[model samples]
Target: MVARSTCQPRRGFCFFMSAKRPQSGLLAGRAPTVSADAYHWRMRYQRIDLNLLVALDVLLAERNVTRAAERMHITQSAMSGVLARLRDHFGDQLLVPVGRTMQLTPRAESLVEPVRDIVLRVDSALGTQPDFDPATAQRHFVVIASDYVSRVMLAEVVRRVAAMAPGLTFDIRPTSEIMLGELEQGRADFLITPAHLTAADHPQEVLFDDTYKVLACLQHPDLAGGVTVEQYRSLGHVVYQNERGINPWFEQWYANQYGSTRRVEVITHSFTLIPRFIVGTRRITTIQTRLANQFAQSLAVQIFDPPMETPRLTEVLQWHRLRETDAAVQWVREQIVAGSHAMPPI
Candidate 1:
């Protein structure tokens, strides 16, 4: 049987149908799908140049061929050639000129995230080392962690990294609702969070276990003879509030054991600022024991255990499961564990 071209266009491409009568056999009915898939797959590999992906990444970022060329340190004509090839391979005008600037088409917009992800994975694969040499490795590690971890663990971890890996640097970002997205997208290398909050699918290691302590001004009269549930509930409390969602383990536990009637007088995001706000005020807050002790040593604050039984805060260092085999990321996780162990146990 001969094949004839269809008048309709599908995804800017044509479809063909056999002129012969429909086959009664099941094998013949499914043959076209498999054949078409294999044909398109072969054609895709033949037309796609991996180098064009690099150019596409830059083009998406800059939205201009000249700017992309400048960043890639290539001639404008060379960049234009790459773009032309990409447009032909993709069967879409990826970028369209809109007066003074260029705009991404709908298809281009859809390709942005996946293309960036592929380019990032490729870069990471090429850049990863077989054996990380901490003594001389020049790398920057990005960490997303809560304020408590930043104060209690990250400071020591960063200090050790600086001493051992002098050429390396660390960027600590505050914990946010999008932290998991950042980790999955390779925007951040490590994440520090409590075990309850850590996703089970990721590669993670427990850094340390911590207990909570109630922090209050040293001269607060109500807290002189150990705090009880009644006193704690009556006093104003300070808690960290961020878009990352609530992390009120203590409050939740208290509500289960006691009741959900405690007053939250102040809500601030910074852990350091919590102490300043509580000083000379009747407001009290629950913090990790390590951080509370550190603050107690310098600030005029008193630390006490919570009245009811509370769960242990098991802090863990996590990375994307896909990056578990990467030597550099493994080394960073090891350094974090070592740093946590070296510190005095909380």
Candidate 2:
């Protein structure tokens, strides 16, 4: 056996303490074993109430103590009590009054997104109901959206709804104004909007994506492939308007990027009528393929290669979870899905 003082470490510096083990020579005795209690020593702690996290999230969103308390269906005094408990647990004032209003302290600000995510996770795991059937269903579904999706996608959604559930009905609500009402009443069923809508915009899902193509009356023979900046400017067109709002974002975007807009002859919200209008005039408007094709069937319009730099089209489907399981609503959604699929993939 080697002398204890002269033994070398396995690697690195020999500054560490040498741990002891039973000696190499026929063991005189076995090493003493440790007790299980040593591994179970207690530390200072108290059980935390998780429901407080939900309250804190609501408080942060409302900001006003009274309003926050109302949203949680709790008394203002109780809200203050919870706020105090939050401050004590965090060891700082989570919110402090500045002038006449409360402002989130640094710690409260950091907890905002995390609290929201946690609340959503808990609800997702434990909150949803388990049954839906359309046969005996009685519910009105409201959908708010752009006219373009209506012409292209909603026609299919409508057709499917009519075919599958003749008893149940839908209120194809137009305009974005109904978003809050639909969400508040739990009435909005399926929505198709860009996926980037704000959280306040409502709960939604990305249904599908589409792209832009130039819609011209087949008779408009002066353009093909890329409609040059000058040629685009020279075309007479029907712009869309909703009580003064410009047509689709594509129109404004194209004008800004190409230096000038097409000469305007009419502004109408009736997307179906645009093709009819263009059919008889020298007007050409760039529109989505959905409406363009719908128009092409009757309006004699030609789909041209989109002028190189147009935004990718996205036809996203969104819906509220309240009626997410309703059978009739689901049939409508499926019809939309199928109808959308029927169109040749572009």
Number of the top lDDT candidate:
1
lDDT comparing candidate 2 with the true structure: 0.57
| Superposed Cα deviation of residue 108, candidate 2 (Å) | 31
Give the per-residue Cα lDDT of candidate 2 at 191. 62
lDDT of 2 by residue, 213-266 (tens): 667767666765546666666788777766557446677667677655568777
Name the lDDT value of residue 229 in candidate 1: 85
Estimate every model's Cα lDDT from 0 to 1.
0.70, 0.57
Cα lDDT for residue 300, candidate 2: 72
Model 1 TM-score is 0.72
With candidate 2 superimposed using the best TM-score fit, by how many Å does residue 154's alpha carbon deviate from the native?
Answer: 2.3
Best by TM-score: 1
Root-mean-square deviation of each candidate, in angstroms? Answer: 13.6, 20.7
Give me the runs in candidate 2 sitting further than 4 Å from their true place: 1-130, 177-181, 184-187, 197-201, 224-226, 244-246, 321-335
